[model samples]
Target: PLAIQQTISVYLIAYAAMSIVHGPLSDAIGRRSVILGGMLVFTLASVGCALATDLPTLLAFRAVQGLSAGAGQIVGRAAIRDLFHGDDAQRLMSQVAMIFGIAPAIAPLVGGWILGWAEWPVIFWFLTAFSGLLLLATWSWFPETHPPDRRVPLAMRSLVRDYVAIFLNPRFQRLAAASSFNFAGMFLYIASAPVLVMQHLHLGERDFGWLFIPTIGGMVVGAYLSGRAAGRMSGDALTRIGFVVGGIGALIHVAYAALADPFAIPWAVLPLFLTGVGVALIFPILTLAILDMYPRQRGSASSLQAFTSLVVAALVSGAMSPWLSHSTLYLALGSASLTLLGWAFWRWERNVCQRLPACPQETTAVEPADPL
Candidate 1:
C-alpha cells in the first residue's frame, strides 16, 4: 500500500513540475509539435514501463510518462481559448470535459478486468498502444493552433519574466486559487478513498465505482448543463451558482459525517455527486478566465493554472489526506474548509474585477458564436 501510494504521488509530482515547462515550450514553438513530441515520449515511456522488471525501473518510466501527460491537456486548453471566446469557449470546454469524464468512470473496471487475465505490466502495454494511436491521430489531424506570428521566443530570461509576471498578479493568484482550492475540496475525498471505502463504508477494493460512478455521472450532467447554459447565463452568475451548489454539497457531507455513525452507501456518496456537478459547472468558466487573463500568453497561463491545481492536489494527497483520513468527520471538515477557501478566493476575484479598469465587464451573458 505504501509503495502504491508513493508511486502514485511521485507520478503526480513529476507531472506538476513538468507542466510548467510544457506550456511555455508550446507557446514558444507550436501546440501541435509539442503535443506530438510529448505523445511520442509518452508512448515510448509506456513501453519501457511495460518491459520493466524492477520497481525502480518502473518508477523511472512512470516519471517519464508523467512528464508527457501534461502536454495534451495543457495544449488542448490553450487550443480552446485560441479558437473561441466567451460562451463559445465555455460550451466547447464543457463538451470536452463531458467526453473526457468517461475515462475515470471506466478505468478502474478496465484495470480490474486486466488483472484478472494478466499481470500489471499489461496495463502499461495497453497505455502504450493507446498513446501510440493517439499520437498518429494527432499527427495526422491536429492543426497548428498557435500561429508563427503569435509564438513567443523560448528564452530563460523571458521564461522567468513571464512566470514572475503571472505569479505577481494578485488577480491571477485570486482566480487560480478559486479554481485550485475548489478542486482540492473534492480531491481531499479522492485522496482519502481507501479510508472512505474500507474503514468507513466497509467496502472492498472493487467498490470504488460506488463512489466514482455517480460522481462522474453528476459531472457529465453538469458539463452538459453548463454547455447548454453558455448563452443564457453570465460567467459570474454561473460561477456563483456552482459555488453555492458545491457549498451545499460540502455542508451536507460534513453534516452527515457529524451525525451518521457508520456511513451508509448512496446517502454518504450522494454529496459527492452534487459536488461533482458543481465542479463541472465552475471548471470551464474558471479555466477560461485564467487563460483569458493573458490571451497572448495563453499557453503559459494554462501551464500556471495546471501547475497550481496539480501541486495543490499533490499536497492534499501526500499531506492533508493522511492526517484527515482517520475519521469521517475530519475528512468532511477538511473538504468543507477547502471549499470555503475557494469561495473566499472567488469573492476576492469578484472585488478585484470590479475595481480593475482592464477587467472584462461581462454584465450580460455572451451570445453564442458559430462552432468553429
Candidate 2:
C-alpha cells in the first residue's frame, strides 16, 4: 500500500514541477505546438511504462508521464482566455470542465474492465493509444491561439522574474491559494481511495464507482449550472454559494463520520457530491479571474495557478492521505480543515478587493498590464 501511494505521489511531484514550465513555454512559443509536443511525450512515456520490467523503471516512466501530462490542462486554460472573454469564457470553461469531470468517474471502471481481460501493462498500453489519438486530433484540428506577435520571448531570466512577480502578487496569492485548497479538500478523499474503498468500505476494485460516481456527478451538475449561471449571476455570488455548499458537505461528512456506527455505502459518499458541486462552481470563476489578471501573461498565470494546486494535491496525496486514511473521522477533519482554509482565503480576497480601489473586482475583467 505504501509503495502504491509512493508511486502516485512521485507522479504528482514530477507533474507539479513541470507544470511551472509548460505554461511559460506555451507563452513563448505557441499553444498548439506545446500541447502537441507534450502529448507526444506522454504517449511515449506510456509506452515506456507498459514495457518497464522493474519497479524503478515503472516509476521513472510514471514520472515522465506526469512531466508531460500537465501541458494540455495548463496550456489549454491559457488558450481559452486567449480566445474568449467574460461570460463566453466562463461558459466555455464550465462546458470543458463538465466534459473533463467524466474522466475520474469512468477511469477506474475502465481500468477494472481492462484488467478483467488483460494484465496491468494493458492499462498503460490503453493510455498510449488514447494519448496517441489526442495527439493526432490536436495536430489535425487545433490552431495556434497565441499568435507570434503576442508571444513572450523565451528567456530563463524573464521566466523566473515573471513567475516571481505573479507568485508575489497579493491577489494572485489569495486566488491561487483559494482554488488550490478547495480542490485539495476533495482530493484528500481521492488520494485515499485504496484504503477508503477497499479497506473501510470493504469493497473490491470494481466498486470504485461507488465513491467516484457520486463525487463526479456533483461536479458535472455543478459545471452545467455554472455554465448556465455565467451571464446571469455574479462570479462573487456563485463563488460564495459554492463555498457554502462545500462547507455544508464537509460538515455533513464530519457529522456522518462521527455518528455512523459502521460506515455504510451511498450515505457515506453522498456528501462528496455536494463538495464536488462546490469545487466545479468556483473553479471557472477563480481560474478566469487569475487569467484576466495578466492578459499578456495568461500562460504564466495559469501555470502558477496549476502549480499551486498540483503542489497542494501532491502533499495531500503523499502526506495527508497516508496519515488520515486509517481513520474515517481523521480524513473528514482534514477535508473540513482544507475547505475552511480555502473559504477564508476567498473571503480575504473579497475583503481586500472591497477595501482597495486598485484591486480588480471579481465579476469584471482587468485591463492588461506589464507582466511584472
Best by lDDT: 2
lDDT of each: 0.83, 0.87
What digit string (tens of lDDT, one per residue) describes model 1 on residues 234-343? 88888888889889999999999999977889888899888888888888888888777777778888898889988888889889999999989999999999989998
lDDT string for model 2 (1-372, tens) is: 566666676788899999999998998888999999999999999999999998899999999999999999999999998999889999988877665555655777788879878998999999999999999999999999999988877677778877877887889899999999998899898878879999899998888889888888899989988999987888888999999999999999999999998997988899999999999998898888888888887888899999998889888977899899999999999999999999999999898775222356432222223453
Ten-residue segment with the worst summed lDDT in candidate 1? 363-372
Could you tell me how far off, in angstroms, the CA of residue 353 lies in candidate 2 after the best superposition? 1.4
- How many steric clashes between backbone atoms does each model show? 0, 0
Each prediction's TM-score against the native? 0.92, 0.94
Which candidate ranks first by TM-score, i.e. highest? Answer: 2
The parts of candidate 1 lying over 4 Å away from their true place are 99-106, 354-372
Worst ten-residue run, lDDT, model 2?
361-370
